[model samples]
Target: MAPPLMTVIGAGDIAAEIDRHRPELTEVVRAAYLVHDAGDSSNPHSSFLRFPHRDRSRIISLPAYLGGEFEVAGNKWIASFPDNTRRGLPRASATLILNDCATGYPFACLESSIVSATRTAASAVLGAQTLLGTRRARRVGIVGTGLIARHVWRFLRELGWEIGGFRLFDLDPAAADRFGAAIGSAAGAADAEIVVADRVEDAFTDCDLVLLTTVAGEPHVHDPCLLAHHPVVLHLSLRDLAPELILAAQNFTDDVDHAVRERTSLHLTEQRTGNRDFIDGTLGDLLRGRRRRDPGRPAVFSPFGLGVLDLAVGQWVHDRVVAAGRGHRESGFFTGAED
Candidate 1:
């Protein structure tokens, strides 16, 4: 057989390439969730590696095999360092490796921060759309102004959400201010009023939608009644809200098993309750018409951010870039291979 093609895609190339392929990214993430919920995907719960000497820093590995329109396996190696931002660098960075299913040969190394952010943004938008139940989002709140938050807002706008106002709250007031300016300058956010809240509750109060993307190791938002009306909490930052809040909300997660890990907010809620009883069906169930949120209560969607999503998006990028002749190609990536 001829040597397998291996592609090395950089972050800049990945970003430019995905600009025209975002719709597919959204669809792939949506499909990954459905396939996963349908028991067609292998999503081993992500493994976290913490540094003994480092505070608020760790790396995560998410491995998955998606079975649907996508039938391949891969893993994402991603790291996060809150201190990186203070040093004027990105907080999170990643690389995605896509492998051939038949031969298990690694075929591509794609810059994955963009892919990770895009997949995550897709999940958040999908969850928000599902929870919205056909209503246009008039107001949205976000805690933590970071790359993930920026990507979520971008995807929301691209997905055609008519957000009238935005509230932002972050531990660093400067981050919030910088993000507020960026959000205001987004393609269609010119007319929307963006507020940088002095308190977390100020951001949470009276919002039709909310996203938590903080980098805290433990829960901070202690008040259960804060989300009393329960605007759909896109619990992007796994461990932010207290368990009592998760208990009172109509909880939905990509995978109940995975979400209840690493001492996430959902995990804490399950431990306190001693069961997964509070979880409403997942996004797949809602897509399958098997689940619905109780209108009387607020909704919380915690996606474990499946690895299959990265694989799907990465695989798509590889195929598209190869066809476009855009990324670097190496035919001898494996010296052990013989033609």
Candidate 2:
């Protein structure tokens, strides 16, 4: 009605929409990856708008289109400022703009940071479960205890993955404490103890799953031997470990092109090896049985966090809310008259 009126979905509202469909989100992600693997989606390499002066801050634009039963198009504009954590602010925030493909008109705007983060967590956890062939991780170690880490914990728990022990490491010990408290309140069933590791290596020392979700520009974890335990690494931050570790692991990604372009560890690995043969296909490939994992080497999954995911999740949220008579609708968004 009335040009399908533009709707605004706030962050809280989006969260509510996601909460209502948490279980379905995983399946939605699976479908998105299946289409992506089948070459049915157009997920361009994300464009980064970095500041010369503000090296630690940048806004990324991920634009994509999904062509399948859930056909839709959208872009996610997300920004991350490392210093924001010092001021008690979220490091990353984003918005998704869903467009009408036929008319190329934006029909909805969604607070998309949640969608982005949740999709990422879902991907990481899904990989862990599928690759490990278990819903639970014996010990989960995280490099950064920020918003992403919290979301990952919640998702794992929701999937009924009993995290035997969680080791957290953040530059700010207070952040670690806070995270521990949050987990304690969320799911500390005696077996789920959150221990703040003073040293980053301690987090990696003995773990079944290791997650690197920090704000790093270049490689630091060099030894590569450090990951000798060969734990499944959910390389969410993209650029945390060194090329040697990347080369040492069986790599999987959401998109080969996008993940290899962002100066991530995999990018560095390509630079060091001078070839792309090391890349072991994508998460979609794994889920679709196109590839298999070898337990001999560490498994490192690096997802480029495609925009098609944002489009799918955003569309899902919009449809759910709208069907329930939600979302702030506004007509006459454009001032024009047809001749």
Clashes of each: 0, 0
Across 2-80, the per-residue lDDT of candidate 1 in tens digits comes to 5578889999888887775655678878888887778888989799999999968999999889887888898999999
C-alpha local distance difference test of each model: 0.86, 0.85
Cα misplacement distance, residue 39 of candidate 2 (Å): 1.3
- Highest lDDT: give the candidate number: 1
- Give the TM-scores of the predictions, in the order they appear: 0.96, 0.96
Q: Residue pairs in steric clash, candidate 1?
A: none
Off-target runs (Cα >4 Å) in candidate 1 are 337-339
For model 1 the local lDDT of residue 56 reads 84
TM-score of 1: 0.96
User: Which 10 residues in a row give candidate 1 its minimum summed lDDT?
Assistant: 17-26
